[model samples]
Target: MGKATGFLEFDRLSEQNIPPHERVKNYKEFVLHLTDEEAKVQGARCMDCGIPFCNNGCPVNNIIPDWNDLVYRQNWEEAIKVLHSTNNFPEFTGRICPAPCEAACTLNINSDAVGIKSIEHAIIDKAWELGLVKPQVADKKTGKKIAIVGSGPAGLAAAQQLARAGHDVDLMEKNDRIGGLLRYGIPDFKMEKSHIDRRMEQMAAEGVNFLTNHNVGENIHPDDLIKDYDAVILSGGAEWPRDLPVPGRELDGVHFAMDFLPSQNKVVAGDKLSEQILATDKHVVVIGGGDTGSDCVGTSNRHGAKSVTQFELMPQPPEKENKSMVWPYWPLKLRTSSSHEEGCDRDWSVATKELIGDNGVVKELVASRVEWKDGKMAEIPNSEFRIKADLVLLAMGFVSPQQSILEKFGVDKDARGNVKADTEGKKAYFTSRDKVFAAGDMRRGQSLVVWAIREGRQCAHAVDEYLMGSTSLPR
Candidate 1:
């Protein structure tokens, strides 16, 4: 341990964020990272417990304590090595991930947890500045070709691993550009696209081919991939968004969050729109309270929305978790994101009855207060109200993987409509179709970027085993 009593002597410190007013003026990263000495102190807060639950809490199973000590001792080069061992992109996770590892920290029992995420952020940013990260090209050629369907974190992870293992890897994306959600779904303000671009450059150097504007099931045939590649990995994400079937759902301004988010991202990337879907000078109501909803709020603010409000069907969680009961596990608590602080009216236990509009353009939302009785929600009879809303975004989350592509492969799906694949036991990650494997959101449904990376890494190992009989890649 860096210091035996570091945990007792030090308190936790989080990274600062740019003022909401200043940040909303443009699309750029707002979080100000910790200075080197501050980061060291935060790293010192890690107890380096004998059994680090933080490791277990991390979906990528990052060696948390080891890296914490490395950073605390200012062994930055080694810290980056340890961070990269499990996670392919710490910069992505550092900004977007909720940091379940901090919640699961041994020190969080009665005090603030170690600032693991910030430490990771500092290490990676420093590594890049020092030109420490580079492509690791394969020394020998396996001559076997592999096709990865999707260019998100999962597909990128699998493609990089397989390519380094001497397989010719092709990462395919249906979109006009690569990075899938990373390139489009996420706003540049949260994490700039340059991070993805730099990694893509490195992957290219490692001999991974990226084919954008290539829709596998539509443009390219499934049979063609089967005939050409030795094996195929389906990392296409769960994209079928959940919808509200309320009255007036067909209104012009009522749209899914995905429908709205991507356009703004494109605009930020310098794409001029003929008819932009904007929330500017309008009352915006974002349904569902989660990361996607928060993102909508932030984007709407950037668009100079007249007003923004978010709705959550469930009641607000406790401000502080009962640590004795929830320690070492992610707790249910109120999470006020940076977007929320940027000026948003948040309402809980609310349900939208319908979109009230005139001439097919949304004017307001008819909503009602709701109460859960016996685990089922019911609208209160006298609590109905109308709220002005020119733009209504349904950020209620995704339902399943798009059926068209999954149907094209004829892969079996579970009751939840996710690809049927065991994450454990002998046939892990293998789909019902031979030589076809699935991972990430396609298999596990909508999830965090960290979980996607983990599944991608593990699925790569499974695919490697199927190809070589025995594999050296870590699961």
Candidate 2:
């Protein structure tokens, strides 16, 4: 350990964010990474605990303590090396991921956890600035080609790993751009698109062929990929959003979170949409209290909405979790995102009953208070209320992967509607269809970007082993 007693000496310090008023004016990143000294101090807060639960807490199982010690010692190059050893894109995870690692920190039991995410942000940004991040071109070619569908975190990670393992990887995306959700689903205010573009450049230099606007199930038949490529990997994320099938669901103003979010992102990326959904001068109601809903709030604020309100069906969680009961694990606590800090009327335990509309456009939302009793939701009597809502965005998470792609490939589905695949044994990641594999949300359903990256890396190892009869890539 770089500093044995440093945890006791230093308090946790986090990165600063731009004021909501100032940041909401433009669709640009506002969260500033910690400075070198601040990051070093934060890193020093990492305890010399024998068992590092932070590693287990992190979806990618990053070597947290190693990098923490390196950052504390001001070893910038080594810090990034340790970071990249597990996470393919620290820039992505550092910016958007809710740090489960911090929750599992030994210091968190009694005190503020180390600012691990901020330190990671600093390390990766410094690495890029110092030219430490570069193409890892393979010395030898395996002559094996893999077609990876979907260019999200999962696809990107898998492509990067397989390419480094000397395989020709064709990373395909149905969208007009490279990054699937990262390019569209995520607002630029949280994580700018330049980070994804930078990695795309690095990946191209590393011999990954990027094919954009390539819809395999539609334009390109699924059989072609299996026939032409040595292996086919389905890294496509879960795109089927959960819908609220209440009255007036057919209203023109009601839209899925994906339908509403992508257009704003496209506009931010300098694309012109003839009929893009905007919250300008309208009363916006965003249903669901997850990250997607928060994103809607941010984007609505940016769109100059007359008012923005967020609704969560579940009861509100405690502002602070009981650390004694949930220590070393992700605790249920109220999380206020930067978007929520901007401006939003947030309510919990409210369920929408109907979307009242004038003509074909939504005008108001009728909802009622709810209470949980015996694990069942029970509506309170005579608690119904109506609120003005010119637009409604449903962000109640995703239910399953798009069945079209799965059907096209003829892969077996689990009970949850995701591609049926195991993470262990010889058939790890292998789908029902021969030479076809599934990973990320396609296999495991809706999850974090870090989890997607982890699944992608492991799936790459599985595919590499299947092809070469052995694999050096870490799972």
> How do all models score by TM-score?
0.99, 0.99
Give the per-residue lDDT digits (tens) of candidate 2, residues 194-262.
999999999999999999999999999999999999999999989999999999999989999999999
**Per-residue lDDT of 272-343 in model 1, one digit per residue for the tens?**
888778999999999999999999999999999999999999988899999999889999999999999999
**After superposing candidate 1, which stretches have Cα over 4 Å from the reference?**
none
Quick one: best lDDT, which candidate?
A: 2
Residue 324 CA displacement from its true place in model 1, Å: 1.3
Model 2: which residue pairs collide?
A: none
Name model 2 segments beyond 4 Å from true. none
Local distance difference test, candidate 1? 0.92
TM-score result, candidate 1: 0.99
What C-alpha lDDT values do all the predictions have? Answer: 0.92, 0.95
